[model samples]
Target: MPIITVTNHVGPTYALEPRAPTAASATLFRNFIQWNVVNAVDGYVVQHIQRNEKYWVQRHFPRHQTYQAVSVDDYWECWRVTVAAGVTTITPARDLINDKFTVVTVMDAPGADGTVGRFPDKTGTRGRWKLRGLVYFVADPGLVIADWPAGGAPSAGLLHSRLLPPIQGNGLARNRQGRLGGVLFRREFAGSWDWTTEDQRIAPRADDGVGAPPLVTYRDPVVSARNFPALAGFRSRNIRTADEAAGGWLPIARRPAHG
Candidate 1:
């Protein structure tokens, strides 16, 4: 198998740098975000969009091992636009834990920053940028992880870099007990937050200010709800606020989060 470096294998919490708005565009450079800042990613909400000249900021720094009993570390990724000055951008979150899942974050430029001198002005210097993505090392993988697999089925955040395993697609590798393996109840970030100008114009200044709250933040793959029993039915601490009767609800999941 030709092992290619894992392309697009990051989840949210790993954001791209700020982008200048432009005209010759589609998603309209609006906003950006990062996700999966800490381990135990299972307790995170996530997906995203664009319209402006904005700088996306994302950081993942953990205090230390606090889960009492669980893995400790972090995971993240970055994104760059394909069409230099395109307007619209939308990336999906397959699930919570980022096992090499390709994450895509989009943005847009509004008002004056988007046309003429705005962007994608084929004839201008501000049209296309080789939007670059660089991974910032956060966790000390060597000290924590004993040994992850070289190849097999893909977990929420496991990446093969270039090694393809026997298992294909997103599901458990084995069938245990009465249901699928201990991985399911997956959720993808199908959420989005959108905004449009009354004049439908890109802002002219760097600080033209018109920021919209993210439609859906953090895009990652998830275990399917259809087979959640495997991951849920077992003994596990519930997210403190998820609001489930101890369980059985999404936002219903609350972390050890406290007031």
Candidate 2:
């Protein structure tokens, strides 16, 4: 998510401070410089990120030898990858966790003489620097309860869900209303239990004006569970460890239909 965010910033700084007489020329030169620089950035930046990561992990895997694995309970927030990687759940888009992601790459330009340049910008070297895949993620600071697994299947459809009641497009859910205070539950009393938990939207004022706001999904989390015909699943960027690729993955077996 952070990688491409850099595209917003690219331009010439002080080329020896633009001279008064050459203002037009300077501006033209700087504009040309900016266009070329950004285009150069985009050419390699766009196409290369997706493939590099797959190649790295699956082909020539790198091991974090010194990296010590920690228990989920002891690990930091970002370090927590859900043990439920394979245990798929069908939660609402917003309910799923691990929402943000980014791609980064390092380009290696090959020189005319077939030599690869180690550094491009600083050396002003002309070599062929190709783009490679770089995967990055952004932890949603707004996630209220995120114990979801890492590399969780990406969310399909409109992955970004909002907590707010429908203000535009679809109307608010029947049970949802102003400033969602909290979800209500019913309590049983007799043979025919009370309908107390029938679902109601209570405002903060309803609880003596001091209860915390009810947490809602600010954005949809990635999900992986469904054979929906019309709708499609999230596009996965598959990567595998070399060891796991020994025999290659087996195809998912299909089941027979029942009447």
Candidate 3:
């Protein structure tokens, strides 16, 4: 679990143009200075991320938060955290909600202290700050539907199942194409699913494009229902969330299997 922490300072607010000779000049200078301040803050953020590329990847999942903003005043401040590494997903939660996302555009550099610095290129803006929370790696398993053996009988050698991506809409499913849209399972033969030798790939795409992967696994015939070595179940990030529900999660059928 990699925790990427970001900080921002909230110092005293002062007009960027300290020595504005006239009201018009002061307003013009303020505008110019405001642009520079924005650039400075934005630049610092970009550089900080670029500097720490070793720890975080270059593609970010962005999360933004505004700290303070005074109505009728030039006091709008906010911070954004961007995850660099490509955490590709079948369907991201933000997408389901029609939220906006920004593709990482900068591989930034850290400031003087090797950490993300606060914004506003102004004096006295030093210590007052906020912490932008951590962005962890997420590989969610929205929902899964598998076929088991009849009552009192262990699953036979062959097993079949369907994997649903995080659900966004009533009928929107993030089904992939060819190899990308599939699932994996670990199978055990000694009456229990063996996680060690689990490399089975279940591709869930058919020529017609409206079918779950017809997965097949082999188990011993002598295996009884009590000692039946079922293929290990999948654990997904989308489980127990509305995303799983959107993925067609069923309480009785698609519930995560307990160890």
Candidate 4:
């Protein structure tokens, strides 16, 4: 699965890096979240954070086991842990604990660092990552509108490499959820492909940034919303924050986000 990493920049001093779960992986986990949010607020609000959290997870480190409890570790995985008494580690150490979940400690780990704890059983070659980071956001009650997914273990501060520079303006050019801005989300593959080989990988001949169609073209399978129960009763107007950038909202017409 291709990973799409995104970052929320705040000034030059802080940022938020969420975990990146592939659209495919998200489809798999949608049911789990929907089941949990069934009795919560309108299912729309429930779906909002569920999808957003997937984006948040890709760029940040896994939340540790505070005292010892089962948690939804990443988009596609859940974890159960038992912390040693008095350990009081702010975060879990990024090591396997009792053949169960991996622990990450805040002192030595931060950002979106550990893959072992990112997703369940991610010890495979396709999942190895070295560093991680995080940022926090409090969604505006009014902007509780709408949602969005993926991928690789990127280094700290580099999560925005694929993003175009943010448009400079005054206070909140877009609404509380960043609705009016043009934020491009991209997917990058490094080294060898995880699910397919370099030769077999498809790349459709699309116009390059230069304007000419590229020579290589590949096919990317579409992730259907039918697979996600969280989206069962979702509506677009309920989550939309503004009127501009409607193209960006196609996927929204298509996803929630967490705060």
Candidate 5:
């Protein structure tokens, strides 16, 4: 079974109020920020994966195969969040954790038709092959921002954006047509944040700008392995025979009984 791994490279840059008493305190505060950022990004990525799975099952998989139910084992797929090594310093203005980094999310869905098994069932002697598709979303830079409170943790709403709707039509339809289908991939800061009062407050925006109020942003564009040049390669893979697809299933062993 092929594992679906989505790697997200979030802010190597983070913004926080410079109010910690000790260096350890500052590191702890930064860790809190890192945890929240990782959670928010992970939530978005999971939603996208679920949306893609639903679309694929409906459009690509055979009619008999239903959407695979998620199990506990599936949750074991490792989710590793690492912060880049950087010096934590306070300079009367604000503290920043500025090290470019990536977070990886792995989804292992064994026995799932669209994710693990062959797409179309073999017909008579005809061979079948397992196929998968990927797509990328490059959100506009400097769109995601977070407002941290001076005395308390930031509100979850401050980091979350509106859920992105699933792309409609057949499998890989958007990629095939070379468009986003009008679905915007950005944080809902305008709708989610209180701009009237919080606009002037200290906040971090996702970007590489320096000397400006610190912000957290995804420096890399969201990309799928099955897009453009790679899309052609994905579509032209050689087919596998039924014997090869059977994998390691063995016949049931039985003991003969005396009459």
Candidate 6:
């Protein structure tokens, strides 16, 4: 399985206007100074990227004679972690903030005990950070529907049977708003579903779209059973929580807190 690695680029722009009466000062104030800073910060820090970037700008470029205002922008680069050998090495890369930083090596194979390794890296003398590998178990649609009986009919001694199809698709694992935010995976269906009494029928009609259920998962359950006459044995599963419906992601490494 290939893991996707994301590199966050934080660029800070310092707007300047001359407060001095010198030609050099006027020239320096005419244009803004921008720096391309990159951080391998994990999902946690990336979640507050804007705030972090503002803090960086404030700390690095304080109020000066020529300083007017400061702004920051974030960009991302993603690549698949692939290695022909058992391990792959990432050489030292330079950014404006950190002169030169080295990315940790990634292993292609799992440990002898069949467990993935946690490779940690420390940049600067401030704090220590660790990178943990993540693997997503995508459900097979065929395998999921295979056990489901044809025609949505309940087996012997069974009152009702509902088919829940696998919602994971080949798209990026994005949110319902279609924003990746800090996530690097593919998109998925994050829509809500309304399971009514009609959906709970013992034998759903062939034209009810029950045979080929919708490709949805982690959907919010809106049960309107009270509106319709309820069956004695028909019971609906508990509604999924927000966190349960919204999947999670682990970043490469979190930014160390400033001392």
lDDT of candidate 5 over 1-259, digit per residue (tens) = 1112222334222222233453221110111111123212211111121111111111111322222211110110001122234322211111332111111111222222222332221111111111221222322221221211121111111222222222323112333432223322221100000101222234445463433432222222222221122222222112222222222111112111112
Task: List where candidate 2 sits over 4 angstroms from the true fold.
Answer: 1-101, 105-234, 237-259
1 against 3, candidate with superior TM-score: 1
lDDT of 6 by residue, 49-131 (tens): 11000001011112211111111111112212112344432212234121111111111111223222232211111111111
lDDT of 3 by residue, 19-129 (tens): 335332211011011111111111111000000100111111123211221001000011122323533121112322211111111112122222322222111111111
Residue 211, candidate 1: C-alpha displacement in angstroms: 30
Measured by TM-score, how close is model 3 to the native structure? Answer: 0.13
Q: Which parts of model 1 are misplaced by more than 4 Å?
A: 1-158, 161-185, 198-259
Q: Alpha carbon lDDT of residue 209, candidate 6?
A: 60
lDDT of 4 at 90: 15
Per-model RMSD to reference? 21.5, 30.5, 30.6, 22.1, 25.1, 28.7
Estimate TM-scores for all models.
0.18, 0.13, 0.13, 0.15, 0.18, 0.17
Model 6 superposed RMSD (Cα): 28.7
Provide the overall lDDT of each model, using Cα atoms, as 2-decimal numbers: 0.21, 0.19, 0.19, 0.19, 0.20, 0.20
> Can you tell me which runs of candidate 3 are displaced by over 4 Å?
1-119, 140-259
Question: Model 6 clash pairs?
Answer: 42-253, 171-186, 171-187, 172-186, 172-187, 173-185, 173-186, 173-187
Off by over 4 Å in 4: 1-128, 142-145, 149-259
lDDT against true structure, model 2 = 0.19
Give a tens-digit lDDT track for model 4, residues 77-183. 11111224423111121332211111111111111223222222111112111111111222223122212101111211111111111221321135455332221
What's the lDDT for residue 139 in model 4? 25
**What TM-score does structure 2 among the candidates reach?**
0.13
